[model samples]
Target: MATAASRSGRRRGGGDDEDDRTAAMRRLRVLSLHLQDPSPSSEAGLAPAACAAAGRRRATGGADAAAALAAYLRGRHRDTQARVFEFFLSRPDLQTPVEMSTAAHRELCFRQLCALVREAGVRPLSLMANDPAEYFAVMEAAGGADISLGVKLGVQYSLWGGSIINLGTKKHRDRFFDRIDNLDYPGCFAMTELHHGSNVQALQTTATFDPVTDEFIINTPNDGAIKWWIGNAALHGKFATVFARLILPLQGKGGDPADMGIHAFIVPIRDLDTNAVLPGIEINDCGHKIGLNGVDNGALRFRSVRIPRDNLLNRFGDVSRDGKYTSSLPTINKRFAATLGELVGGRVGIAYSSVGILKVSVTIAVRYALLRQQFGPPKKPEISVLDYQSHQHKLMPMLASSYAFHFATRYLVDKYSEMKKTNDEDIMADVHVLSSGLKAYITSYTAKSISVCRESCGGHGYAAVNRFGALRNDHDIFQTFEGDNTVLLQQVAGDLLKQYQEKFKGGTLSATWNYLRDSMGTYLSQPNPVTSRWEGEDHLRDPNFQLDAFRYRTSRLLHSVAARLQKHSKTLGGFGAWNRCLNHLLTLAESHIESVILAKFIEAVKRCPDEKTRELLKLVCDLYALDRIWKDIGTYRNVDYVAPNKAKAIHKLADYLSYQVRLVAQELVDAFDLPDLIIRAPIGMQSEAYAQYTQHVGF
Candidate 1:
């Protein structure tokens, strides 16, 4: 279908020059592919561009489409305008007052964020949109209010399982629902201990059931057992969903919660009126953290804190007045999974935020590269820095990434929604693993991508005026909170290998299975038809036109390496027995990341409506796929055999691709749904001229 770009002749905002031509070429390739076959997805099975457009159409027709359209169009225009005015808004000319205050900058950013939050809140997609308690009364009334209100509160418990409900019996939900919406109370979820992070089995805070008084005594055994690093608990929160071991007089469980395991209780952290610690409660602020300063993090310790025995958050496990411990879920792992499953929402939130940050980064890099003049211009003075081959190599792939992550986030969001529906314990376990794994990967990618955006912006990127510095700080903690990346990655790897090993038969057929899956069509593989077609001969031995080329060869070569790993795994018994097979596991995870990215990049190119946008995105995707394949030529190849000449040629192409993308950076950023104020960078807006900034900043 001919994508009917608007009559303005500016379907995408930018210049008309050599850079435009380059971007156009890239787009034509993608558009041609889409024209050939207009299926929902590609050879490797990712959704095609048509699907995106179609989705957008359905989105507009949704029940609240009018409201969503308003939000989308406003955000879209806001972002585009922000990039256009990057120069003046950069604050380069704004003189620093003698007193030196930053009220203007702070207010500018806050207002921007507030607008963005409001924009997202009003979107048609219920999951994507925040269900504000004030706006959606039923959501609040049904106890689902926490889903959106929790995000709105920006509370310290970013992990997602927090409830305003006093940790009483499941019966408490009845009373808590009405009062919670009324703001009669506030709360936090305190599960992690100072000693162990991932290992929840080791918490030491103890809750002793006193059958005599019907009041449970919750006490921290030592300083280590104290609940440290609680967020809203520092100020806003009136109570906490505290995790401590349960001790019963009848049962022989020791004072150590480990014997009874961790049980959650509603413990009052502060006297709401005075903001003072309730009796026997000691609280302090965690001061500052690496990121997410909007939330007030805190430290809390309990010394014989007393609460009614009914104060147990008994959704999972419960205690009766008789000091009996009972749980709806039988297995301890299931209960544990339920406890941690609360983080799933957090993972979803981070995933959404990560996409936003990536889009912002791409916009800044592309716009700056386009307008910031450097090197030569035809007869008319210096050219835009985007003309530089080196520049394109840096920014284009990341541009491709912004698109890819958007799609991946869509798939991930759907998966999380499904996870929420199933009451099955087994399904919940899988959800936990999937959510944790994807969150780790997505957050890690966002962190890395944001840095690349910074570096792409050059010296300007390093400045807070560019917004990357701040966004980088915001994204930095994603790796640690929820779950540490390394730890989470290991867990993901473990889960992957576990699944793979379960099907491991006596035959070492990993290689055979992979090869046949492609040739015989048993793989049920994705739409990456080319990657599926590998020769029996090793890829390193071939030197055809495609092999000679870096990007094409990168995907092909990795496929071969992946084939080899599959063979290794099939032969290596269980993953546990394969002590020396860590490398294979690592590559397996990495290969999937490459596959998803490749699919998205190709899909974006195929489906993008604009001729220029499609062309620019194709090159970005190609460059990205190649960058991954050869990033570590040392470990990838047995010898440094890639001729320096061939390497330079590939780099040249990557540079060319980057240049094409840089021209359209402003347009791409605009599509990301950011408001101009939130971007808060001089080069972030669309309409500003470079000269204005250079003159103002004395550049």
Candidate 2:
């Protein structure tokens, strides 16, 4: 019940060295009790009164609670995927050193990847086809072990193998599935060109159909059309799932060929027997990246590369031997959407993996805070860094955010899995918008969170052995790849406008968008005086109030952005108007995604079956909601939705909630269940942290 200042003041009073040491040991013991085995038999190691207190703590929220929460966070596949994570921990050979050259790191990552498949028995094709949840679970575990290994696996399986499964027909699958599964046909995804990254429809690489030879000639027409940053292409991959403009030649005239939009093709870039770059194909290593050097990213250029006609991944669109184009989709735009839609699993994976990175980073920061001691009252033992409000302020909210994102990304994964199963247009549309928005939202948040965590750990975080630098470098590309965060946000905003129009037209809204309709009356009404002035802790923490505030901000932004676009379009026209309002559109998109995350987090808390665990989660949720609302208070206050006094109260409440969360920070991170071997940072060890860190630094 004592405040941090009071605790420090009490320690400042005179005490012998032996007394100070004893007090510190006692505090460490109490703080670490939850890290011990929570079994009743383990209590025999403690005194009777201590054992009784430990029993009470376990009943409230302890190791058992952490285990239950971990299971819940892992979802239905927790048990099935346990071995996947354990597999990495058991193999010391799979672990990369703290330092290595790009070439050496790439070779090590490749060897580690092979071990993951051959020894660990990771069947990505089978899991993705039959068990998507398990496939993602395995991916999270792999990414937690090594970002480079995860990216390599994603390129080979999720991008290359997935293209065959999702975009190609049975014959294409029959030809390549076995080879890809056994690692015989190493491959890369060739989508981004030098001139175009996210603008897939504008990519200039051409796949010209040749009816005479019954083949497709793939060519990079100019320097800008060369495929760039392709993983596994420089030395490892023998094939690539190439994205290009499918062209049909004119029958008699030779003016121009008909461009049938962007499509994917199975193009062989290297020889199978000798691992040599094939004729007319040029591959160059994208050397010395800032991070993820373990991934062999390369640039690919093709000059009149020819492949059989059947190599086209033609589930959505196809061409005949007679040079005629056919597609189930009615128009090029719809076909393009469908083609890109099939690959959305990549975004889902990135969003999920970003959370994994945050979990590890936050875990290290929080654990180090608990162990590292610094300034305190003179003549007293220095207090733990976590005891300071500033340290808690920096870390607890992020810890809370890690939990919030855990549930939100879990929802995304489940939704993606459902979309794959039903193939419902509505679900597909929801998944597309959801994936893009969450992918941008979560990755950007994590990118910032990693820096914050690294700074929170002070000098130790700067050391390479602690992993913050590598984590930052590897994760930095996540926001740009899959889709650029900026462009992806616009996609979400564009969809929001479409739904807003659909609401006006009296069309039924999808489940995710139905909130748009429900919030119409609330958002348009004048601010409620009573609700605006209510600033008590209960009011601030209420799920209803938090959700309403989030919903109101998004709805208001949506309406205002729509009106601005309409007004601007009258003068500037559509493209110009959209460009003028890009900033507003991004805010609207981010607001909408934050609302979705909070809604999902609240729902997850309500669904918890364990009362003690649920109670702990509710506190974390409160911190997440209030901290976000408090940060954006200016937005709420400008509209008179929150009074000055209420704004102050929200800020104080957020601070208090952070202090509360810090009390159980260890238990919260323990639920992530990362092992020491996987964590790899000596300073983040559960016990003997100082010794491990000293040994790591060669003291």
For TM-score, the strongest prediction is 2
Report lDDT (CA) for all predictions. Answer: 0.52, 0.86
Task: Estimate the TM-score of every prediction.
Answer: 0.67, 0.91
lDDT by residue for model 2 over 18-39, one digit each (tens)? 6889989887765444223221
After TM-score superposition, the amount by which residue 65's alpha carbon in candidate 2 deviates from its true location, in angstroms, is 3.4
Question: Residue-wise lDDT of candidate 1 within 541-641, one digit each (tens)?
Answer: 23222222332333343344445556666767555333455555555555444454455445545665655445445554555654554464443233333
State how far residue 541 of model 1 sits from its true place (Å).
21
Weakest lDDT window of 10 consecutive positions for candidate 1 = 138-147
lDDT of 2: 0.86
